[model samples]
Target: MALRFEELDFQPTPMGEISLRRRYDPAARQDVYEVRLGDEYLMSSLFTAAERALATLALDVLDAGPDTGPDAGLRVLVGGLGLGYTAHAALADPRVAALDVVEYSAPVLDWHRRELLPDTAGLATDPRCRLVQDDFFRRMGAAPQDRYDAILLDIDHTPDHVLHPSHAAFYTADGLRNAAEHLTPDGVFALWSDDPPEPVFEATLDEVFAERASHPVRFGNPITGGESANTVYVARGRAAR
Candidate 1:
């Protein structure tokens, strides 16, 4: 067998230089697609369990109970379009009526539009999904009241580790309050953190939402052959104090 390698696209964005590449991994015995921001590995197709969980875990909380029908026509806002795992996972649920994905990188969106990442390209054509080019944090602040049933984020590395300094505000008490405005009463807000659960961030969530939970999703690391975990912070939106 021969090795496969390709640099699908590369461009300079407001954030920095971004590149998309496709390579075949012998250990994983599969083709993998990756997106990078300069020297940082933004996302990979090989390890997507946590990204997918970000959607499922949040939506599950909104799932209908015995007395209620399915939470049909659910509207969701996904903060990142990395490889489309989260959006795809959200659309997997029959109840999801719409998924609005806000991505700050136009090149990233172009990659999906051109099908550079085949597995994730389906998102572009999915009737339930909409790809918007904009700053997620800004859009969240400008969003109308009760505009979304759930808001799923995977933009930054973590609440404390942000790619851009401006993003730090989103994790603060006031920043989170702006984001909460977009959520329906009882709406769900879930964020994907590359690191484990942090007490400080959890405390911030408690301050912003009436109810919240921190979920540690563990998955087998193909390269390490051991379990690695990511934190998914889920909070229920409530009227501002």
Candidate 2:
């Protein structure tokens, strides 16, 4: 279905078009995507603040390295490719050796390849990017042992706001155990949430990562603002053996 930008909240971007629908009822849902930015939400679209924090926090984790090589060459795994904000940010960093961006939505991928690539013009399609269309939770379990330098997540609005029930497993203590197996000790796992996670979720991270921290990103200020107070969870994995 061709999106009806006229009927939704329109936000101008350097790319094609982005619209948000805030009127969905109990059963109906909405998808939010940006013209030049990213798809912040699907059913509850229009939360770009959360997306930006997801990317920024991942980068911050990468920068907090005592053991990172002098070259800063690191492999990164980003679990969601909503509007490519995380991908774009990773590409901007000279420290990133490779970026594996996984997105499950085919239309979202097409829109990105067709609309975003042309509009952004090769800024994000660098040689370092490897876009994979797959379920992040499944991939996490199947990924090789201790492989990635960083794992950035923005699969849902928050740990509580799950779009797919299967994803709940990814937030469980056991799921984080699997995620830890995929990290290269000292590798970072950055998770973006619309709000601070539940106590159980926070505990799960503490149980899995060697170091755990949460950073709050503020939005909606004249000088530095956009939407809401997004939170980023930073967790470090054991060094790759």
Candidate 3:
């Protein structure tokens, strides 16, 4: 049994004030974990279908590719820590050899290191997963020499709707092209969006990737008593500029 409601941690960050909370949900009959940035609820354990999909869908493409073999080990870069759904999902696939999670908020990394949330408890200790405190967008812009087999992003709400103005550039053609430089030749890039598929953004993918797609992931919304959906954009084979 869990308490009715409890705030586990709170901290003021450069982005905004963030808090971690846990509450007992009568409908699910279990404890629900939530992360809130300012007044905005960033994520909740009550719904995680899309977050998990962001990893699975991206890796599935790799599984189907010609590179997949018993000796093929994948290196993945995850841009966002959130509730650890995406990280945990990436780890679930044995093909993943290394995972680097970049999060701007130090407090979020601290929470995962502290093991305050069950979903992320082992994230900090996992040998394969590295918790990095850095701006994901900045790293992408730098175009570090290191490359990854797959890059999964779940930071922004959407291309149109971003938490910070700095992240806005990432959705554009040039920014996406920069991100594509960090991927292996056949590597994949996957992003999670809260909105439905946007054709305009899909065109941006065309400018950067040879093969790209946007997948709509629908899940049950208990609060609305109906279905809600999110989009997962996947791209691979960087296009010649």
lDDT of each: 0.87, 0.66, 0.90
lDDT of 3 by residue, 1-241 (tens): 6699999999999888999999998887789999899999899999999999999999998953235564358889999998899999999998788899999999989988989888657999999999999999999999576788899999989999999999999999999989988998899999999999999999999998999989999999877779999999999997776
TM-score of each: 0.93, 0.72, 0.94
**lDDT tens digits, residues 58-138, model 2?**
677565333456534777888877667667777767777778888876655655665433323453467878878878888
Best-matching candidate per TM-score: 3
Give stretches of model 2 more than 4 Å off.
Answer: 1-49, 63-72, 117-124, 143-146, 221-227, 238-241
Give me the runs in candidate 1 sitting further than 4 Å from their true place: 64-72, 143-146
- Which of candidates 1 and 3 is the stronger one according to TM-score? 3
Q: Is candidate 1 or candidate 2 better by lDDT?
A: 1
TM-score of model 1 relative to the true fold? 0.93
| Candidate 3 error regions (>4 Å) | 63-72
Q: How far is candidate 2 from the true structure (C-alpha RMSD, Å)?
A: 8.2
Separately for all candidates shown, the number of backbone clashes (residues 3 or more apart, or on different chains) is: 0, 10, 0
**Cα lDDT over the full model 2:** 0.66
